[model samples]
Every structure is written in structure tokens, then in C-alpha cells.
Target: MAEHTIHFGILGCASIARRNSRAIKLAPNCSISALGSRSLERAKKFAKENEYPAYVKLYGSYEEVLDDPNVDVVYVPLPTSLHVKWAVLAAQKKKHVLLEKPVALNLKDLDVILEACEANGVQYMDGTMWMHHPRTPKMREFLSDSHQFGKLKAIHSVFSYNAGEDFLKNDIRVQPDLDALGALGDSGWYCIRAILWATDYEMPKTVTALREPEFNEAGVILSCGASLSWEDGKLATFYCSFLTNLSMDISALGTKGNLRVHDFVVPYQDHVGRFYVTSDLGWAGIPEGADPPPTVHSIETDLPHEAHMVAEFSKLVENIKSNGGAPETKWASISRKTQIVVDAVIASIAKGFEPIEIN
Candidate 1:
């Protein structure tokens, strides 16, 4: 009830929301004020299992959460198909929105959500938790160092997890109506975002999907890859899947240096994250010696990246509520750029793996 605190209403009881609820609790200025789902009983069970504070309100429908006068922010972990609908409604109701990644099925839908937030003066941020990790900025510092990293020439990102039989057959990600984009939206999102982050959000000139994406019977992507080319000869490739081993890697090669991270999407450890950098010399003589081993950089955090994300978002929400500040545009812009690239990937796949211009 503090003036600077943010009251968050969770729009669903999805599996991801449980992790987000923990984040809300850890965020300094945020509290889980309400929980809502299609089924009231399910919502109650989720609230109970998550150990939400007794003060948390439970609602039978998402509308009730948006209608609550006390809820200052709405966290949307709903399906991709429902994101624009509920997110726009939440924004229109003057609730700041913390939406899950792949912000929408396509850029068009994401734009609608963004426009609503802008019109309503509500803060909007996607659930790309890695962006808040301290290690990310440190990596960016290395990438931007011309003397160390030089000009970025190429990058590759991979993110995958073996979903097993039940997931491929029963999960919402593989369902056509619920999350038709499947692995591309669910997993590839991080890969695309990482690529964009490495390039400072400079969109690629064109995107071409790798041939033959694996698809379920419902025609949802289970695995796919794509190549992106920038105007200045910078190139990037990314692979994502729900049918492979757990692997998350990003290799960014520059003219003079290279950066590699095995856990770009999610770190193995919650408190500390690491990335490697190799700079200056390469191709060592056989007898002389190779460049020194890639220097390992680890960042320590008091809270998990997800909690950091929530805290950062809540700070913005609090500023708008207490200081009458305009909604921050940086987060919305990044979400828009990420979705644009995702749309291009989808378009290229649909067009028989031809290159799609990123106009």
C-alpha cells in the first residue's frame, strides 16, 4: 500500500506465472495483488500453491483483474493468441503491462498492444528476463569495445530443449489454436532477441529461414533456423527447437574479438552468470602459443534476473504513478523490434524459405 509500490495482477496461472510470482515477491516495489484465470478454482489453487500473500485477491476472469481499482500492473502470461486481446484491454484500463515474450503472434498484433499502452500512458515491457541480468551489460561493454571486439561480423544463437512425448503431443505450444507459432515463438524468441541485442537492435536487411523446419501434424513449428543479413555485411544465424537437447549458446564474432555464452537465455546458476571473451590475437603458431584462454566474466546478483526485470519494470510504473512521468519507450521499442524480426522469420518460412525483406 506504499505510495511507491506497484500492485500486480497476474492474468493467468500458466506454468511460467509461478516463476513470475516468485519474481514479483522478490521485486522491491512490487506485490502480487491479484490472480485471475478462466476457472476460479484453478486460480485459487495456483495462488495457494505459489504461496501468494493472503492479501492477494482471486478472480474468476481476466476482466475482473483489469477492473480492480487497486491493480497498477498486469502480468500477461496468456497464450500468444490471447496476448493482444488481454494486453490491450489491460493497457486501456490504465494498468502497466509486463507481457511474456514473443509479445504477439506477429508485429501487427504487438503494435496494437503498444499503441494501447502509449495511448493510455501505461508502461509496457516484455518478459525477456535475460536483459536484466548484469552480465548482459558487461557483455555489451565488451562487444562495443572497438579495440577488443572490433566490428561485429557474424553471430550465431541456438536455444533448444527436448520436450519429450507429452509436450509434443499435449502442450499448448504445439497446439494450433493456442500457440500456433510453436517453438519459433516459445523458444526462438530468445535467440532472435539475443541476436538483436548484439547488434544494438539494428534490424537485419533480410531474413531467410533455413530449409525444412520440423512441424507437428497441426503444422506448428517444432524446430527451425534462419539466417539474417544486415546492410553492412553483418550476418547472423539462429536455431531453435523443442525436439533437441537443452542447449543455449550465442557466439558473436567480430573482426578482432569474439564472445561466447553457453547460457544466454537462462544461466545455470541463479545468483551468478558468466560469459567468455577472446580478444586481440588469433591463429597462434604451433610452437609459440595460442591466445590466452577466453577470459571468464561472472556477474553476481542479489536477485534472479526475473526479479530484476520485475523490479526495473515496477520502478518505471512507480515513477509514472508518483511523479507523473511519461511511460518509458525503450522497452516498447525493443519489443517491437524483436517482434518485427520474428514476423520476418515466419514470413520467410511461409514463402518457401526465400529471403524476406525487413521493411
Candidate 2:
């Protein structure tokens, strides 16, 4: 914390890495000190294109990046399957880790990554950037206000995309080794996370899953629904899919009012949109215009680097510098629970739509 800057290394040259690289550059007191890729030419090219400093090294192997003494932290933006392996290796070297989302393919791998971090006394965290956004903080605060949404009633969330066959053909997101990435993990996780995040993971005492298997190809889930406990005496329904055209929306209903957010997942560069709300009193619109409304804020730039990657990586740096590091909380717990729901959906499909309750 004493220094004005922190040196870091990137472990992959994928598109995710490119976004994280730009975020680190933008974050105060953080810098990409090195980069590594499986291909020597790729590593060199990436380093040159980014104008990484002379001290910033380029390595053909990720291990070399981990071994760099100048590298205080490691950003692993590799495939979903490789997340656990690289996290463990970086932790072994006593390097703080900024791991990509989903943490790992399953809970077992997530435990190992956490164990490695604990054993090595290094910080490790999954980068759920949206959860760290200023709006997220505001959402939490608003949800607590009695007049904001009144007593909770039910909630619904949706996140869908038409990832054409071309993407599935070559992307690891669709590989069997990667757990047949489909609606469940590919885009569905966003919906699950949103529910847990919005509700503070307070509901969902028991979850029953149902999947529309026809939307799945190669055994990957395409559409899913879950019956969850919305409140003490109420229940909520959830839905997500990746086979649809495109949709990203969330709604939380209550006795007094309701909050509906449209295009929630990825807002535009200008963040211009209308989030509608209705109550017994009347209807109102919270428009994100040149200036965002209260409780809603836009990223600092019109560029792509303004993505959630900034908030995600910044949290890693802040935790690493805080000595004992940030305390683990419902965030980690809810992610594990969400994965269980995904598994339950898979089980339901295998059982001919027989609903399975999440333990």
C-alpha cells in the first residue's frame, strides 16, 4: 500500500486477458509488468501491442510468468478448465490471484484453489466484477429501505444470447472437457448470481430445477427454471437460457412496489436506458441518461475497458494490500450454491424432468 504502483503479470493472451490488461493499466497503483502465452510469437506480439514497459517480460509458458520476481500478483484469464491449476500454481509461488469467474468447473476444484491460497498465505478471489460495482452497492442499500420495494413478493431473472454454432465450434466454452458449456454455466450463471446478489442470498431454502432439454445440444443445458423460496412465506421462479435471441432482464416484486431492470447484464457505453418501476402510488422511470439517476452509475469511459473487469481486479489489489485480506462472505458461499443449482439442472434433465431439490 505504500507504493504508488503495483506490478502484475498476465498468464494468458486471450480476449479476457486483453480486457483485464487494459483494466490493470487504468487502475491506479496497478500495472501489467509481464505477460505470457503458450506461443512465443503470441506473447511477444501482445506485449508489443500493449507497449508494456521494458521491464515487463514476455514468456512462452505461464509458469515463467508466475516465477517472475517482479510480479506481485497473477491474473489467470485462461480457459474455464485451467482456472484451478493456474490458481494453485500461483498460490504456491505466494502470488495473489485474480481468477476469472465460475472459479472452477466444480466445487471440488474451487475447494482446492481456496486450500492452496490459504496454505500459501496468499490472496485468492473469483472476479465477479458486477457484484463490486457502485450500483450493486446502491442496490443493496435500496433493497433494505422499507419504501424501496416494500415486503418482498417474488423475483424473476433472465439472461440469454444467441451464440451461433460458429462460437460453439471452436470455443472452449462449449468443450466437453469444460463441462459442455451451455445455458447453465455459460449464461445461466449470470442469472443465478443476480438472484443471489439481489436478494442477499437470503431466500432459496430449497431449490427445485427443471430444464428444457430440447434447447441443449451435446448434453449441455440450454434453458432452465428453478422454484426458489422468495421470502419467509413466498416463493420465486427463475429462468435462463443461451439458445434464445437475446435478453437480459430482472424483476423483483413486492407488496408495495416492484423494481424492473432491463438490459441489466451489459449496458451500453453511454449507459442510456430506462429502468421502470411501479408502485401502488404510480409509475416512474429511472433513466440512465447523460447522467445516471441516483443509485445508478455508469463506467468512467466510452471504451470497452470500462467493463466489470476494472472493479473485479481492483478488489483483488485492495484485498492483497489489506494485510489479512478481505474476509470471505456470502459472495463465495452463493457462488458454490449456484453451481449446485446448475448440477441439479443437469440431474433433472437426466431424470426426464424430474425435479431435484438442492440440499
lDDT of each: 0.92, 0.67
* Poorest lDDT segment (10 consecutive residues) of candidate 1: 282-291
Candidate 1 shows a clash count of: 0
lDDT of 2: 0.67
Tens-digit lDDT track of model 2 for 84-110: 889999989988777776567777777
Q: When superposed on Cα atoms, how far off is each prediction in RMSD?
A: 1.8, 4.6
Model 2 residue runs over 4 Å out of place are 1-4, 49-54, 214-217, 270-274, 281-331
